[model samples]
Target chain A: MAVDDAVRTALEREVGVEHEELLGEISATLTRRYAAAVGDSDPLYHDAAYAKSLGYANVVAPANFLPGVICWSEGAPYDRLREDGTEADTHLPGVPAKGVRVMGGGEEMHFTRPVVAGTVVSRRTVLLDVTPRDSKQGLMLVARYQDEYVDERGQELLRSVRTVLLR
Target chain B: MTTPSDLRVGSALAAQTNDTSITQVFRYSAATWNTHRIHYDKEYALKEGYPDVLVQSHLHGAFLTKYCTDWAGRAARLTDLSLRVRRFAVAGETLSIAGTVRAVRAGEERRALVDLDLVETRGSDGETCVEASATVEVPRSWIGEGVLP
Candidate 1:
């Protein structure tokens, strides 16, 4: 599971591939709880009547709630997380890096619409781009991944581009 | 005299201040399903050369949104927000985000276009780490009314 030149080459070559993941439905209560945990009291995300007035069945999930959907793959080739809960594997497939740390820079989110409650949302992830960088301390890699959220009717709810620094 | 009519392209807005801690970041991580190693794993974060598990990017973005939406009041809707990362912001660092009115015009039939400069400054070191721009649509009738929007 150690990161090596071979892993970097494989990740670099695998760019532009799309990974589709189906997320289990999180209850509406949990959805609103997430918003509350962030101290967001926006009625559109919590008040059923308010969301119903906006033509929704229940509360709509906040725009930044997409990351709660990643279900870890079982038997994936990546190293199993250690007792310390740290996976020593630096080179994740679709992410290019030989050695160094990976940090999430941020995301650019475009909301075409808000998410509706009671309906399970699906994620369509695509490895958009990959680039290499050199730092004084060590080598660095940048991976751009796009996650698109869709509702039951296949309408695009939101699109997020997650940028991470791979070392 | 800093009303919408007096706003100019180069004019800057007042800064909004906020302090975020690791505890808040942990709560957000638990709530948002963000299992990224760089966010909460100290060993992983240090191995990656970061000072500590850093604040989630979306959380930082949320703070920036709060800065504008709180100022814009209820009569405004953020139409478009676009930002590029200039530097990394870690936990325990209080951030100050500011918005400057860039341009104002009629966007749609009942909406006024309000463009702003979104900036996040580190409260400890006073360094600007993020730069963004956004366009908001504010109702014309929101002014001078105690009830916003």
Candidate 2:
């Protein structure tokens, strides 16, 4: 599918508009599961006692833990999911649910603080920009989204700029 | 094991290797709630011009994350990580991650920062799959003044 006028216009409208969500607290189980899934044997991520000994309140999350998770909540119902199995309501707000393909191009993350297991976190996401380009497959729209994650006291934990390719 | 005190600008960290398997890939997809067909549907991936179901880009990031955290151990904290996916790796390929200390800088009180250049390369053809850089915060006592930036 080509990046038509409607797609460009829809994406342009979302630039700089912030969408906020309370992603909830970081859990030891989820953090451990993510680390295990990646085959990390580091005791700091698996053992709370070890992490506490190193000055952490609980098991510490990996560097990419927050941005690595695709969905933070229970996720949408099957009917609400896009064709590619992504939630239609979050992330790509202005892009249509169907006929457009979306993929993660890359990310730049600044981990300001370690995420402990019990710290409640919230995210503020804003569409940074969208650029149109021609590719062998067709017209591709490279959209950049900036996300900032903070704890309950408003302390920043992480900030990231992610690039998504939509075609 | 490489400790923060022993790290130098040209010091090399230990390499970790992961043998990518279909089961591992599926579990990664399930863990992340990623329903991308290119990561699991072999037939759909074939249509997309890949040899097999390709590993998710985030999964590649996970491997790199593991490598950094494992190297830093408990005494250090990873402060920044930035990476770009240069190529794709299939389910059965082996991916190896390695890092080199690039620089050392003064950080917040009692902490020193170490900069690392990281790479994840496909074992088969030695092609770079992901290129990354990271900043880790370690205790100032762990670093030697000779390596300070």
Candidate 3:
């Protein structure tokens, strides 16, 4: 069998495992930068006074802000990085850290509560399933991961089922 | 505020456009801690057959989210957002988004759920790069008579 197929088999074996991570706090500066980067001038992400007027304790992260954060850790050394410039340990639960290329397919998200600055968040991610397919890029696997985000108090902020394409 | 009177099934929302720049794409990747070189390395993007560094899929989703949130404002909350990237949009491409109301139903308490169908099109070729849907929860008072229970 090809190495890619073998990798798929290994990935398939890890289906149903749960991975959790404490993503630290959502900083106001981070949220502001994200909103600015996206060219979103929404005052809720920038002005605390405006957010307060809206009944929030402080500025709030925009919709999709939680899932948009790709890496939570400080990251590995440069030498440990893949040719694609991504760190293995930071993502892709089952697949080997090297060789495989990963791409974001899409996302289905539900916002249960607003995420405000200074809120420490945690995520429980489960590999819901993985299916192999043949694409224009040749053999690939589509994996769906359901990520549940909660506040320090365990209140659900949001949940998203993210689709990742591995080649 | 996207009041109930503003959300009618089949009614079209105003269109908004964003002229994407390479700087914007790189900044988004950096802010997200996404080290993917395809979003910053022009050479790598060319080797991958793209005209230039491509926009991240999540960026496409963000545009859709902005579209909904900008329209809804503070009076409404975006409860749900789902999107699929249908094509790759290179840097410097203009992304235009517009939505139409799909349905309205009673939500929790005095809130009403407004569903919208959104499409993000690339201005360079008029091709749709992403298709999305959103559910915004708004005050039921904004709904017109007989629109919802």
Q: Which candidate is the best by DockQ?
A: 3
Give the CAPRI class of candidate 2. medium
Q: Extract clashing residue pairs from model 2.
A: B5-B142
Rank all candidate structures by their lDDT, best first, as comma-separated numbers. Answer: 3, 2, 1
Candidate 2: segments with Cα more than 4 A from true spot: B4-6, B141-145
Between candidates 2 and 3, the one scoring higher on lDDT is: 3
Off by over 4 Å in 3: A1-3, B1-6
Distance from true location, Cα of A84 in model 1, Å: 9.5
TM-score of 2: 0.92
lDDT digits (tens) for residues B1-48 of candidate 1:
133434445557677766777887887776765557677888877875
TM-score of each: 0.78, 0.92, 0.96
* lDDT for each residue of candidate 2 in B1-149, tens digit (9 for 90 to 100): 56656767888888989899988888787777777788898997788788999888888888877787777776788888888888889999999998998988888888889899999999999999999999888888877667665
Chain A TM-score of model 1 comes to: 0.77
Query: Candidate 1 residues A13-105, lDDT tens each?
Result: 777776666565646887787677666778977899998997888987765565533332332234444322334432234543223345566
What is each candidate's DockQ, to 2 decimals? Answer: 0.35, 0.71, 0.85
Interface RMSD for candidates 1 onward, in order? 3.8, 1.3, 0.7
- Which one is best on lDDT? 3
Please estimate how well model 3 matches the true structure, expressed as its whole-model Cα lDDT. Answer: 0.88
Deviation in Å, model 3, residue A133 alpha carbon: 1.7
